[model samples]
Target: MKAIRIHEFGGPEVMQLEEVPKPLPAADEILLKVYATSVNPADYIIRQGGNDLLRPLLKLPMGLGLDASGIVEAIGADVKDFKPGNKVYGVPNFPGDGGYAEYLAAKATQFAPMPHNITFNEAGALPSCALIAWNAIVDLGHVQPGQRVLIHGAAGGVGNLAVQFAKAKGAYVIGTASAHNFDFLKELGADEVIDYNTQHFEELLHDIDLVFNASPVRDQSVRMKSAEVLKDGGIFVCSQLDSPFPAALLQVLAAKNAIGTMVGGGSISYTSSLHGTTALIEEGKVKAVVSKVYPLAEVAAAHRESEKKHVRGKLVLEVAKEN
Candidate 1:
């Protein structure tokens, strides 16, 4: 099996596609012949070692990818929910050899049946991003219908899904993005879209019941501003799992009596989140937002694009064709 592995952290150029031994299922795992995977900010961030302190913690020569959609080639003795040839999609274990390979052997609990309404490339784009969005809006925020829910970076991978998920939950969804994406966010069910380029969101909106910061941009200013718009006793959710909640932002939330929480990639149940997203997709209430599809060999190119931080949706890597 060929996999993209980075022996040392640096640039997208560090990712190399090489012949590697195929992985086998563990006692509670499933071996999947991956049809596709998607590029995420985390992919490029991890490829470059995230930061100085984190760089030392990464094991060199690891595969890069968090999402996968494919057919089950085999299952472990302990995995009875799926059989050989089942179509599935989910997040593979992070900080390990990932889904950017011809095959993956991951814990069966990390997966769910792929949404029947989407293509392999689309399914590949959903798992990690959708899980993050679900965790933020559903689990942490506890958004309710008619609540004013604000989402930052509404045009990005997780942001777009967050908008849809919030909408499906009956919240009045508001999104912040560049002016060019205003229409796109609205199409994804945002009741209102603010252009972050020319307008400040805090100045325009108030009494927001929930604020979800899903943007990849690391500006603490967004966090402070987001804290301002929340209604008293509102919820503020952060998606930057690796970063701590700043004291200033915490103070802002405290002043408003708003709750502040951070969501991690693995903080929620993968099976349940994927199942919820699948239900939405199959019911036509949600859609996969794929920006581009790259051949698995062009992973380096995809990384370059993801590093730009301007991709509207996910950039997918085609690993194999569904037969």
Candidate 2:
């Protein structure tokens, strides 16, 4: 099997496609014949020495991918929910071997049956970003119907999905991106789109029910201003779970009697998250926004594009073709 592995931490150039031995399923694992995977910020972050939580668990020569959609070639003896040949999509193990390979043997619990409405490339794009959005808006933010929700970085992968998910929950979604994405965000069901470059969201919007900062750039000033727009007791959520919540932001939340939280390795089961997203996708309430698809051999180029932090949606890696 060929896999993208980084032997040392560096740039996208460090990711090399190398022939590696195929893995067999463990007692509770599934051997997935990967059809596709997608790049996320974590892929680049891990390639560049990882962060506090992941650095210790990572070893050299690790496969690089978080999300995958594929067919089950084999299943371990302990696995019961899926059988050979089931189409599935989910997040593979993190800080360990991942899905940027011809096959991946991961715990069965990490996967769920793929949504029938999407292609392999689109399915591969959903897991990590969808889970992050689902966790932020549904679990942490507790976004309610008719509520006003604001999403930062609304044009990015996670932010795009966050906008859709909030809309699916019946929230009046407001998104912040560059002016060019205003129409795109409205098409995704945003009631308002603020051009962050030229507009001051704090001055323009107020009494927001939930503020989800999905931007990868960790700007404390944005968080402080975001807190200002929240209604009394509103929820403020950040996607950078690894970073500490700023004290001043907390103080602002405290003054408003609002809640401040971050979306981390969520406690919800992967099965539940994927299943919910699958339902929404099947129901036509949500869709994957893929910016580009690269062959497995062009993964380095894909990483380079993703690192620019301007991709409108996911950058998918085609690992194999569906039969």
Candidate 3:
């Protein structure tokens, strides 16, 4: 088996595609012959050594991905929900086996049946970011019908999905994005779109019941300013994922009467939140928003594109086909 692993973290250069023994499923896991995977902010962050504290604790030589879509080649003795040839998608939290590989052995609970009508590429583009959106919008925000939901960075991976999820719940969705993506967000069910490059969203909208801050420093880290538009008792969930709150963010939230907290969706609980999107995918109300696809061997190029942060929707890794 050939998989990408890192001996040291710094840049995409750290990821090495080398021969390695294929993993075998544990008694509670499933073995997947990976068809596709995806690049995420975490992928780049981990490769670039941004997680300084976690880096020292890592096993040194470790795999470098989190989300994948594949076919079950074998199921563990205790696994009953799937069998050989079943298609699945999952995000197994890293520091474990990774997705940028030919095969993966992961806990059965981390995976779900891929929606029948979509391609492996689409499912591959989900898992990590989609689960984040699901957790922030559905779990943390507790969005309900007739609620007004505002999503920052609404054209990006998680924000795009957040818009759809909010719409599915009958909330009036408003999104902040560049002028180029205004129409795109509208197509995703955003009732109104604000061009963050030119307009201030908080000035234009108020009484928002929920605000999912998906922007990573765009609008200069608006978590605090975002509270200005939220209704009293509303929820504001910021995704500072795998990092501490942008300095003084907690203080700003503390001053508000609304429920405000950052969403750390990369944990094991992300797998459970994925189950919610699985339902929406099956209902055909939600799907991947992939903007590009690259071969598995070109993962470095994918990382570069993700780092640019202008990628619409998501970027996918075409694996089995590349092999």
Candidate 4:
């Protein structure tokens, strides 16, 4: 099987596609004939050695990627919910095995049957980002109908989905993005959109019930301002992928009587998260938006694009033809 593997941590160039032995399903696992996968910040972060803390725990010759959508080619003896021909999508054994490959074997519980309404291209990108959005907004944020919800980076993968997720719960959703994406965000259910380049969001918005700071961590000021827009008891959700939530930010939340939340590895909860996202998709309340599709060989270029951090939606990689 052909797979993307990195023996060294550096730039996107460090990832090399090579022929590797295919993995077989264990008693509780299943083999997937991979059709598509998507690029996440974690992929590039690990590639660029930004996650040095994890390096000591990681083995060499690791594959890269966390989301996949494909047909089940084989199932282990213990697998019951899935069969050999089922179409499935999810983050399988995330942070351990990568999904960028012609074939992958992962625990059967790690996957859910693919949403019946989408193609392989959209399905592949929905796992990691979409599931995380569901967890953050629905599970953690407890976003309720009629609440005022503000989502930073509302046009990006998690933000875009978060906007819709908030809306689905009947929240009044506001999104921050460039003026160019106002219409795009509105299409995705943002009730109000702010141009981060021109407008100061905190200056104009207030009394938020929930805020999802899906923006880059480089903008440290944004986190503080996101906290500023919240009502006394509003919740501020930050991504743990980049910066840790500083103690000062926690103090700010405390002063406001609000909560600062950063979700971490809940590998045990992934199956439920996948099911939540799938239910939303099946209900016609959520849709996966992909900005670009790259051939498997052009993964390096995908990393470059993702690094730009302005991608309107998720970037997908077609690992195999959808036959």
C-alpha TM-score for every candidate:
0.97, 0.98, 0.93, 0.96
Report the candidate with higher TM-score, 2 versus 4.
2
Winner of 3 and 4 under TM-score: 4
The best-first sequence of candidates by lDDT reads 2, 1, 4, 3
Model 3, span 1-323: residue lDDT tens:
99998888788888888999998899999999898899887788777775754565467678878799989999999999889999888886465467899998998888888878788999998887877888888888888999999998899888999999999999999998889998888888899999888998868988889999887554435776788788877888887654556656556556667787777633536456777788888898987898999988999999998898888898898888722
Cα-based lDDT at residue 192, candidate 4: 95
Model 1: colliding residue pairs: none
Best by lDDT: 2
**Steric clash pairs (candidate 3):** none
Candidate 4 on 1-323: residue-level lDDT in tens?
89999888788888899999999999999999999999988888777664745556566668878899999999999999999889999887666566899999999988998889889999998888877788788888999889999988888888898898899999999999988898999888888999999999889998999988877545768988888889998998876644677787888889999988875466336777788788889999999999999999999999999989898889999998775
Residues forming the 10-long window of minimal summed lDDT in candidate 1 = 49-58
* Model 1 misplaced stretches (Cα beyond 4 Å): 52-57
Off by over 4 Å in 3: 218-221, 242-255, 265-272
Residue 23 C-alpha lDDT in model 2: 95
| lDDT measured at residue 196 in model 1 versus the true structure, 0 to 100 | 90
Error of 1 at 39 (Å): 0.5
Better of 1 and 2 by TM-score: 2
Q: Relative to the unseen true structure, what is the C-alpha lDDT of residue 261 in candidate 4, on a scale of 0 to 100?
A: 81
